[model samples]
Target: MSHPALAFSEAEYRVRISRAREQLVARGMDALLCFAQESHYYLTGYDGGGYVFFQCLVLTAEEKPLTLLCRRPDVSQARDTSLIDEIRIWLNAEDTDPANQLRGILSDLGFAGGRVGIELDTYGLTGKNHAAIQAAMDGFCTLVDGSDIVSSLRLVKSETELDYIRKAAALADDAYDSALDTARAGVVDAEVTAAIMTTTLRGGGDVSPAGPLVNSGSRAIYGRGVGGPRPLDAQDLLILEYAGTFRRYNCCIERSISIGGPTEAQRKLHGLVRETLEEMQTAFRPGDTLGTVDDIHRRRLDAAGHAEHRFAACGYSLGATYRPSWMDVPPMIYSGNPLVLEPGMVFFPHVMVGDPETRLAMGLGNTVLVTETGCEVMSRHSLDLPVR
Candidate 1:
């Protein structure tokens, strides 16, 4: 059989798996039942989303081959994309419980009565499946929440991973430039989204896991991308938040466009957001806590009387992530989160300000890479709000 094509090399996968096993041993775990698809992809290069069903990768603390328990459909996905060779299939039946099947695999791997770690913090492991796993492994092995084991290791990127992020960043810059050019009076908001997506894909990037969030007029103040796109008003405010993804790695950019000549208030808001983003970038220093960066965002916005208009989090970590989000979070830039800033850690710091009462919004952001002394802002676009 032909070998599966992996994003990273086999040696890299081996290093990651070895490091994960080391983490397992350090955590006093005999085995780790991986649930997060990111974890599987990171450690074994298993890139399938069968995790939406009941897929799991079982890794032992010892030097044993990795095993993946998934449905029949993912058998090829695992074989074709990952270094994992031991593929176990669980059949679909009205009475089938894959968690029990998982227990049998554990027993076969000599994990009976051993201390096991389960990643309980992912969308991959739903509550129903958690209960089933709990019931199946009850008295068989002690389960501990070791969700951060792999995620912590993944926070610091390798040079190869950073290469992908840099490429993604270039694509994101193109998408922003394309959106700037495509957006105009009477243009539909979806058209702007299309420009962004097209720029990303044509530049060899994958579709962003979440949104190339494009909203206009009253929707500019919304924190999230709402369904349905509408035409731009003669004079409008458009908010754009998007990522360029390469091999699932992401680099994000968020900005607001003034569709026509900006009002005094809109220009003021844009100035404030741009200033806040600049200040936040200046604070992106290694050894500083992620919260410290957010503190600058809050202090500047709150002092400017836009406290209610700002998001609680100014930004978050960015990386190779799956659907539902481009933000690789848990280390979100919020007040009092003490995750220390480290070199090679990538972040998207956005300064977003909006007033629902006035229906005005302004946002300016960029992806940055933490360095030894400070950080490097990845976006090539100017901080000035673009007026179309």
Candidate 2:
């Protein structure tokens, strides 16, 4: 199906609602109130303005009609397409509080001072919005951190969700191809970055998680930023990582290409990361917990003589929309969280452990999905180091 046509279909919305209801019961909650962008998209098909405009969904545990709150600008879309219990609008100024609007809706929906589970992890209720919500509740509502429940609900990926992710991966792969086709001696960092961005847009990509990591050489290897640019030398490492959004689903990937000849150290280190990643892929069974997989990555890194390097920046959850802003996490870096590997959980496994002393960044990641037997690597670009 064409992306534009299937991006927001009603048929897909039912799948999300059904999945969320299962999670709601498991969390032992009466309702799942999602004010975060990613959560909203996961539950309902409201990806308008992503998390910026503050669209929200309130899913009851009983599978009753869901409540949807939208900004005035998005009210029409919510009414037309959403399977919401009651649709309401909350007018929000740049710095004004949106409390009364929030409270009034919750109050009208009978969510008074009870166990109102909410996904308020990322500053959703911390500023003027918090104050408004607090005042509106008037000690009637008890807001609790809902990340655990929300994460549990979204742990497994749906086939439709995978389709969006695959589309995103294809777009990012295009950026990688574009970067290689145009890379050469003396190209500036900005030029390379621009090429990736333009190529992504032309290939039908939307906004990525944090834009393209167009850093080359040393910059590209690290998990944080791109490498330094000195144009492309002969066989120089051209590290490229980027993703484009289709609807709110994001597909991200990173690949390295040598301009002329690959250095022995670069080849060795890149291979090490790849080999280690492959090992992790081998152990990624459907029943393994995220915590266990994280250990597997760290142990592999330590065994490879990266014990001194902290395995801190190596994972992200890939799903409905590009994290709705960087807070969406990769699943491997969990701590005691027992989220099981399912048939459709997509994770951005970015295995990295870089030290500043060497100024060399070496890591690899591709949005992967867990299947019934094992996991599948969505990215196919080869990051082969040089024979030299």
Candidate 3:
């Protein structure tokens, strides 16, 4: 990378290459076809919209320098970012039938009859291009989910990755707090979302060009959007679930505040969730595994008679993104992935308990890092309800 401080350099690139070879060897596979954007960036540091042209890479077990197949424009960018040596260009227009281009590139790379690993979920062309690629690969290559092999390596962060996450968490909290202050009644959810987005940009953060969460009230409770009235009302609880992104890394901080004092029920749930969070943080120390910590959260919920009011996945991984990207916890809190918490990994434990019976939901969260001894939390927000 051009920036000495931010981007990976030649040495780091070699490390990635070594790890790729190791993964291929361990997986008992000889070759791989990676199309996932994150995977692409991880391997090569080439971050462009491959979906536009079906650009992708092929890695061989023979430890050959990686090969990239994409529209002509991406060659230089790829060279700067990825560890690959051969970057092949498609003669066809980027928006045209890219699958044909993919076939040509693959055949030229001698990947004709082998089991080719492909990132199914992340790689693709638009409908037109995808159809063409699908037709071309019909009888040629065997595509499988090669994610596990790569993910096993990516989950462990280096010191550099940790710094980015820490910065991202701070930036997210700053934006989240601003949205909390502006979440008075009569405010639109979109407005709150916009504020967070603007704050990230203004704070010298890389926001990934998209806003985080904007759900108000119940909308905030759902993982996606909270469809409701456009404007909020006094005494209404505006729940905000959002974060700031830095260079594709992201964090999730779920907080809710009342425009005014809370109702009796609201206060109770708020107290419960807040207390839960406090107890959780208070009790957790470094060296706690994912399963152990996840269990503790649930145990407290059970003791409080909230066994059923919890989020499906109460905790998630953190970095320049969320969802599929950040959902990689080793203890399998959500999916039972069983990853040990090393010193560098980070997780945001967010516990949200929703009681539709009272139409009141309360949430508590913190951003934590796994250190050699235990965990260190960087979040300053508390479980108490936020106010203007």
lDDT of 2 by residue, 320-382 (tens): 644335435635454455767777887776666565677565657677788889888887776
Q: Tell me the deviation in Å of residue 317 in model 1.
A: 0.8
Pick the winner on lDDT between candidates 1 and 2.
1
Q: What tens-digit string does per-residue lDDT give for candidate 3 at 134-226?
A: 688888876556766655567667777776777777888888777876677777767887788888888877754234646555554555554
Would you estimate the TM-scores of all the predictions?
A: 0.98, 0.84, 0.84
lDDT of 1 by residue, 1-388 (tens): 4454789888898899889889999989999999999999899888877989998999999987789999999998899988886999999999988999999999999999899999998878999999999999999999999999999989989999999999999999999889989999999999999999999999999988898789888888887899997999999989899999999999998888888889998888888888889989998889998898889999999999989999999898888889888889767889898988999999999988878898878888899999999999998888877789
Clashes of 1: 0
User: lDDT for model 3, on a 0 to 1 scale?
Assistant: 0.66
Model 3: CA > 4 A from native: 1-6, 72-84, 91-97, 121-142, 208-210, 218-220, 227-229, 279-289, 321-332, 335-337
Tell how far residue 119 is off in model 3, in angstroms: 2.0
Model 2 spans > 4 angstroms off: 1-11, 18-30, 53-55, 62-65, 77-81, 92-96, 123-128, 226-236, 322-327, 334-337, 386-388
Residue 52 C-alpha lDDT in model 1: 90
Candidates 1 and 2 compared: the better one by TM-score is 1
- The CA lDDT of each predicted structure is 0.90, 0.66, 0.66
Top candidate on TM-score is 1
